[model samples]
Target: MTLHGRAADAREASHLAIPVGSPILAGAHRWSDDEGVIEYGEWCLPPRMTIGYEYQP
Candidate 1:
């Protein structure tokens, strides 16, 4: 998994309901097993939104 902050493009802006070039949080993740990749995805979040994750090991 990887995350970064970048300016929203036109497509991202439209779907996120934010103006183009606005700052946004973007991320992509990949999950794989022995055979091959099981899942992969990319996503963007609005600037004002907050997201968190907790790991227990």
Candidate 2:
């Protein structure tokens, strides 16, 4: 069994995501300081990732 962690919106705000190919999004996940231990079944992203800025060019 795998169990992930979830923080509040305010607390999760600290969590940043690693930039895939953009410098602006570089090291974004470093902002989160209240990160709790997470256990993911598959560390890889899902087939369809949540592209918040998929349209950005």
Candidate 3:
């Protein structure tokens, strides 16, 4: 999924996606501090549950 506009909104959406298909809890983060800066954000899959993405840009 591609999200536009505020990055915070996009980060929120990524968190909501982790539970699809009943995946095991891995780890996630949205590294935004009080400085109002977002450096990185990502989520992980269980060792047995791997996923791939196709990027065309």
Candidate 4:
């Protein structure tokens, strides 16, 4: 998984319903099994939104 903060591009801004060059939280992740990647996705959130994750071992 990877996460970053950046200025939203035209496409992202449109989807996020914000103006171009607005700040946004973006991330991409992939899940895999022995054979190959099982799932992959990309997402972005508006500035006011928050996201969290937890891991246990």
Best of the candidates, TM-score: 1
| Tens-digit per-residue lDDT, 2-56, candidate 2 | 3233332322233334333322211112222358544323222322244344555
Candidate 3 residue-wise lDDT, 1-57, digit = tens: 222222223344366553334434344445567897476554444324556679899
Candidate 4 residue runs with Cα over 4 Å from true position = none
**Which ten-residue region of model 3 has the weakest summed lDDT?**
1-10
- lDDT tens digits, residue span 1-57, model 4: 898999999999998889999999889999999999999999999898967779899
Candidate 3: residue 44 Cα off by (Å): 2.4
- Residue 45 error for model 3, in Å? 1.7
Q: Clash number for every model?
A: 0, 7, 0, 0
Cα lDDT listed for each candidate: 0.95, 0.31, 0.44, 0.93
Clashing residue pairs, backbone N/CA/C < 3 A, model 3: none
Looking at model 2, report the run of 10 residues with the lowest lDDT sum. Answer: 22-31
lDDT accuracy of residue 30 in candidate 4? 100
Residue 56 miss distance in model 2 (angstroms): 11
- The residue-level lDDT of candidate 3 at 35 comes to 90
Checking candidate 1 for backbone clashes, the offending pairs are none
- Please provide, for model 1 over 1-57, each residue's C-alpha lDDT reduced to its tens digit, 9 standing for 90 to 100: 999999999999999888999999999999999999999999999988988889899
